[model samples]
Target: MNRAVRIGVQIQPQHADYKQIRQAVADAEETGVDIIFNWDHFFPLSGDADGKHFECWTMLGAWAEATSRVEIGALVSCNSYRNPDLLADMARTVDHISGGRLILGIGGGWFQRDYDEYGYEFGTPGTRLADLAQALPRIRARWEKLNPQPLRDIPILIGGGGEKKTLRLVAEHANIWHSFSDAATLARKSAILADHCADVGTDPAHIERSTGVRALQGSSPDDVVGDVLDAGATMFTIGVSGPSYDLGPVREWVAWRDEYNARQG
Candidate 1:
């Protein structure tokens, strides 16, 4: 497959009514974003920590009904929150509802607040990765056993940069790998991921590379786009939030995406 760069917008789900969120999704698709995402957390990860927030899969279920075309999923769902089989079932249901536009973005999880409040274990990182390693196959197996089955083979997006274990799990399971580091760091990790793929006999090209870009950090979308493309990332996401869901940065990204594609062509 050609490694054409794409843009994603994570409508940060904080301090906004569902009505505003719904409109934001519509605006994003209209602006030509390739993917739309929301973080999976019970509470705000940023401003006003106790601000109004929504559940992940449930909001995705709603997104299935609200949006007609754009791919939608969690930025990185906490794998420890729900059982693997149950999560697979939820992904399947959303896939069917969206006519196969769902991506199962998940991770071993790091937020202690969610684990503590939800009664899940706030175990060591290695233990959480171990659980994730076990959960991946079970999720895939359940997808095969489900009655209606998924509308399609759902893509799995794993987020983390752990070289030894996390990247190894990604090599074994992920269809997409999301990381939260700079371009140089991502380049190094991509090489590490390639080594893991070699060890496991899986082609490194089978996994899409995704990374989050912060627009206000004095980096233009085009600048980030160039760095990410050079670093082997195909999917670049910008996270935005508001009581209004300001789309200024998203529009800039969409414009950059068009230019990038045109240049490639």
Candidate 2:
């Protein structure tokens, strides 16, 4: 089945109180976003180096109860932070809480500060990728062995653009592939992903293409969104940060999504 265009909002949990963060999630859902995401990190990715930040999965558990209609997950969880089987159990519990609306977006660990502060080994890029490769199957296996299964077969969304290992993992395991690439790079990487899918015997079309967009409220939809769609991306995410989480851009993107999906139909 061809995937429909969808809008996702990532409410960055930095420099904000839990009250404000909770409100942002509610507002995004109320504005009609299809998915709500938060990043997995120990500290702020931007702004002050020592800013207020919240942990990922625990916040996701809260979102599962707080939200009713929007799918919720991390934009991409760092694989090194938690054990594979434990992560699977956490995801499964969240899935049940959300009544089956979880998307397990994960990636090989980055951000050395998170590793250092948390006492996890800050390995080389290749080592991290190899760890992720080994973890995916274990996560899946644990999901099956859990006493109470996940409310649904939770969708796996993998984020990264490495043509060799990351894209290969997308082919072998991901139901969705998220990347931060422009149209040309997206097109090139997508072709590489298709080849990887062929090697794994998985249909490339089965993996939904996701990418990040910025300032959706300021751009002409045709010029900004049309190009990415042309490049084969259908899930467009806008990330907003801080104490005052804004939903104005999210509403605009939701409108754009409706218009685009109508046109596709």
Candidate 3:
């Protein structure tokens, strides 16, 4: 089936109290976003390096109870932080809490500080990718062995743009492949992903194309975002940071998504 155009809001859990982050999630859902995401990290990705930050999966568990409509998850959880089986169980539990609205967005670990402070091995990039490759199947296996199974088959959303191992893993495993690329780069990488999909005998279209977008004030998002749509992307996400966690851009993107989907229909 052709994927619908959707908007996701990544409410970055940095420099803000849990109260404010929770409110931002409420506001994002109220604004009609299809998904609400938080990043997986031990510390802030931007602004004040030592800023207040929340852990990823625990926040997702809270979001599952707090939200009723929008899908909730980490924008991409780091694979190195938890055991594959444990992560699978966590995702399954959250799926049940959300009544099956979880998207397990995961990626090979980055952010050395997270590893250093958390005491996980700060492995090389190749090692990290290899670990991710090994973990995906184990996670699926554990999901099957879980007492109740998942509420449904929780969708796997893999995030990254590496042409080598990452794209290959997306072909083998991901239901959604999220990329951080400009329109031109997205187009190129997408073709590469398709080739990888072909090698794995998975339909490229079956893997929903996802990418991050920045909403500029007074700008018509269609030109930039439409170019990405033309490149086969359908799920567009915009990140909103805290202390304040503004949802104005999320509202704008949700409006665009509705209009875009309506026009497509």
The lDDT, on a scale of 0 to 1, for candidate 2 is: 0.93
> What TM-score would each prediction reach against the true structure?
0.96, 0.98, 0.98
TM-score of 2: 0.98
Clashing pairs in 3: none
- lDDT by residue (1-265, candidate 1, tens digit) is 5677788999988888888888998898899998999998888888998998877788899999999989999999888999999999999999999999999999999999988998999899999999999999999999999999998889999999999999999899899999887778989999999999999998999899999987775567866666768788888898988678878888888888788788888
Clashes of 3: 0
* Candidate 2 pairs with clashing backbones: none
lDDT of model number 1: 0.89
* Every model: Cα RMSD to truth: 1.3, 1.0, 1.0
What is the Cα root-mean-square deviation between model 1 and the actual structure?
A: 1.3
- Residues 90-157, candidate 3, lDDT per residue (tens digit)? 99999999999999999998899999988999889999999999999999999999999998889999
Best by lDDT: 2
C-alpha RMSD of candidate 2: 1.0
The C-alpha lDDT values of all candidates are 0.89, 0.93, 0.91
- Order candidates by lDDT, high to low: 2, 3, 1
lDDT of 3 at 1: 68
List ranges where model 2 is wrong by over 4 Å.
none
Model 2 per-residue lDDT tens digits across residues 1-265: 6779989999999999999999999989999999999999989989998999999999999999999999999989999989999999999999999999999999998899999988999999999999999999999999999989998889999999999999999999999999998889999999999999999999999999999988655576566765778889999998999998887877877887898789888
